[model samples]
Target chain A: MPEITYRDAVQKAIADEMRLDDSIVFFGEDVAKAGGVFKVTPGIYEEFGAERVRDTPISEQAIIGTALGAAITGLRPIAELMFADFIPVAMDQIVNQVAKYRFMSGGQFTVPLTIRAAQGGGGGFGTQHSQCAESWLMNFPGLKVVAPATPLDMYSLLRAAIRDDNPVVVLEHKYLYTLKGEVPADASPGSIGEAKVVREGADLTVVALQLMLHRALEVADKLADEGINLEVIDLRAVAPLDSETILRSVMKTNRLLMVEESPRQGGWGASVASMIADRGIYHLDAPIKRVNMENSLIAYSPVLEDEIIPNAGKIEKAVRDLLAED
Target chain B: MTTDSIARLDRDARLKALNTMTTIRLAEEEIQNLFMANLVRGTTHLAIGQEACSAGVAQALRPGDSMTCTYRGHGHALALGMTLRAMMAEMMGKASGACKGRGGSMHMTDQSIGLLGANAIVGAQLPIAMGAALTAQIKGSGAIAVVFFGDGATNIGVFHESLNMASVWKLPVLFICENNLYGEYSPVRATTPIDDLAERAAAYGMPGVIVDGQDIEAVYSATLAAAERARAGDGPSLLELKTYRYRGHSRADTGPYRAPGELDEWLKRDPIDLLLGRMIAAGEIDQAEYDEMRGAIEKAVVEAIEWAQAEPFPELEAADDYVYYPG
Candidate 1:
């Protein structure tokens, strides 16, 4: 076992995968010489060389489209968009071309590509550079979206996404990059559409994704002192949602609290809550509770940002309120 | 560049060009009838007048070379040697189609014949074609990618991006702009300031050649030279073929843009008819042979129609089948 940060886990996964498969190449603004804006791809250029670890121009559309082409032509490419908010420039490639190619081509081609971008608002990067758009991508049918909240999960999920035969969007929360945790040395590549239960409890189940997963776990620990059993599940992948695991947790705990960092409207929490309401409604003893950011652009100021996003206190309060219901 | 060499193509190549154009024309004509009869669904952009561009460019390409086309792609697919039966079946939404009926008329693709795919989105194929060419260049496959687009694609930002990238990277690609004078009922003059679409390539520092698209010999010569340059790793070239489409932009168009006299004048310069006359005057074939070729083409067209009509529709559950790998 090794204590590694989430950023190091991602770097290790990319390095390991690139070592195993020569076809796995990386490119983005400052990803090569500068080691990526977030340093997730640090020192990769020295080991892999400039050809494989490429530095591209600031054209996001070209970055995505070229990666897509390379992916379809037998190379596994991991493209880094500097920030998640800048993904709009490349949306045509991601949404129209990459997402639909496999389905539109009748499965003749596979887009084995990973688009990694730093998401979430906590670094005072303002509205343009911050914000989580995982829900917007979830609206598309042919894409797989993933967000790993911990070091071990990041390592395993990155490996899994690289091996997938379809396009995968890995959203890295900028706030969780340096967060450290114990990661197993020989952790196997994990499945895409499965939820990992971080903490098991009997009273209430808290379903959280990305950065909010850690918050949920913190809330669960805090509520444990009050004799309230709180379970926390990290939804690692979003598109091929692990509804079964979430519903089974609801069936056991009989209470649910969904958490996400995206806007409250059409967020990952809304989808999770809807899934539970549709299939696991009868199993629930109380209505599903959701904890998400307010439906507004993330502000730059620390106080305003904190006011907009959901926190551990909010999760703990939401869980308490759900438990208080009849 | 010599006229003597240009005239030495012999009778077979000439007849083949004529035959290819005639096949495309007849197939599209049959498609029009089928569409009118409610047998074919979705939009069909018939390339009736632009046959020489497809036939000549397709002839210039080697068997393993690749092609990407715009939504007006029936000609490209047919010219690339896809069986009329498969194409018609695709247009009719039958399982026997090239894309298993998933890609209707606009998106037909046959990888076996090097037809990468016909994209419905304008200028979208530019980057994809450049990528294909890059793949060919990297693999040292000697396979060049030819992208066929209409005059309207010149205005799209992706077109410029692709051209610039191709020029900078020196990718083995030939960008063929079929300047049919209109972009969905709107004339090119209304939108474009420059009359010559080939001139746009000047921005990328690539050689741009404008050819008489009605003349199959002219198109063949220009494309052959461009293909040679690409194969030689001299970078991509822009070949703008000045042509027109006899039919409307799509099936729903009544084609009222052109006057009756204009239609009649353009019809007189039909590529198929011009090639047939040249072959006849050169003693390439007798009237009996010509009539026999015509009769055979008609029979093939009818058989293709019958095959499409008799083919089975795709299964309902299979809609999601090809979206990803089954395994």
Candidate 2:
């Protein structure tokens, strides 16, 4: 067992997989010599050398397309975008070329590429750099989207994403990079589309992911002392959602409250709420409530950023309001 | 009109090259007839006049080498050795088609022949080809990646990004731009500022050459030289083929926007006819042999259409297949 930061977990997962598989190559801006702009992947280049771990120009489209090209031709490539907001810059390569290549080619090809991008708002990276863009990619059927909230989940889920035959987008919350947790040496490469019940309680089921998961957990802890029991589930996989776990939890708790840092409209929470309404509507004792960021550009000020995005207070209020419902 | 390049090809090589160009020409013509008959569901882009570019480039590369072309890729797929039956079946959306009817005219693919895939989006294949080259570089596979696009694709941001990255990494790739004088309806001049699209290669620090696309020998020679350089680990190069499209952008476009004599002017330098004239001038074959070869090819193409049309459409449930690999 090792206590490691989420950032180190990502680096270690990539390094460990690259050692076992020569087919795995890492490419991104300043990821090699400069050790990544986030400093998350520093020693990989030294360990694997320039061929396995390489730096790329600031061309997001080329970075993604090259990863795709390499993936289809018998190599598993891991591409890192410096920021999630920049996902739009390479949207065509991701949504059209990478996502559709397998289906478009009638399964003649496989794009086993893992695209890692630092996402979420809190450190004041401004509108262009800070966006929880996991929802943007969930709309596509061929793509798998995962957001890891803890170091252990980050390590295990990323390894799973790399090993996946389909293209997987891993959104690492920027604020959680330094947050540390005990990660098992042989953390199982758990399957995607699986949710982790971080805390189990009886009163209500609180679903969240990435930074919002941490916030909801904190809210659940505070409310637990106040005689309110909350079952908090960390939705690690956003696409092909772990709806069974959610519906089962909703069945028990009879209430569902989703917390997310993305825009309210078309957010991950919105999609989950719609699904719950469709599948588990009769089981829910109250209307499904969502705590999401306002549909506005993330601002530079920390106050405005937190004000817009979900916080522990918002999660707590939503939880209490759901319980107070007749 | 005899150059040292055409002389390099012996009588058999010359006739084979002519046959490839003619096959592509006849196949494209047949596809047009299929479209007119309402057999092809969506639109199709026919490379009727750009056969030399496809034939020349395919001849230059080894069989294991990879290639990707634009939506107007019927010529490239045929040149790369995809069966006429598969191409025709794909156009007709039959289960026996190249992509098993999952992909239509725009997304034709035959992985067996190393035709990576044909992309419908403009300039989308550039990075994918670079990636394939990256794979070759990593595996030390000696294989190269060739990507073809229209002159309009050169203006795309990804096109520039792919070239810069490929050149920076010394990836084994050939960026072939078929400057067919138009990117859809607009002529190159109306859309692009530069006269020669190959000049864009200098910014990426790669050797960029312009070839007379109608001349199959010239295209083959230039591509072979570039491929050799790539195999030697020199880097990527951009090849601009000065060619034209006989038809409009897609099936419905009648080229009303083109200059009146533009189609006629390009037809005068038809790729298949240019190679045929070269072979005939060198006494490779007489007009009778050429006619007989074309007739046989036309007959084969017609039969392929019949076979493809007879094939069944894919099961409706197949839409869910291959979205993700079970593996």
Candidate of highest DockQ: 2
Q: Model 1, chain B: what is the TM-score? A: 0.96
Residue A190, candidate 1: how far off, in angstroms?
A: 2.1
**Pairs of colliding residues, candidate 2:** none
The candidates' DockQ values read: 0.51, 0.86
The digit string of per-residue lDDT tens for model 2 on B231-293 reads: 999999999999998888999898899898878888899887877887788888989999999
Tens-place lDDT digits, model 1, residues B191-310: 999899899989999999988898888888888899999999999999899898988989999789876687788889988888888887888887888788888998999998897889
Candidate No. with top TM-score: 2
Residue runs of model 1 more than 4 Å from their true location after superposition: B1-8
Q: Tens-digit lDDT track for model 2 on A39-149? A: 999899999999888988899999998899899899999999989989999999999998899898888998899999999889988988888888899999899999999
Docking class of 2: high
Q: CA lDDT of B163 in candidate 1?
A: 83
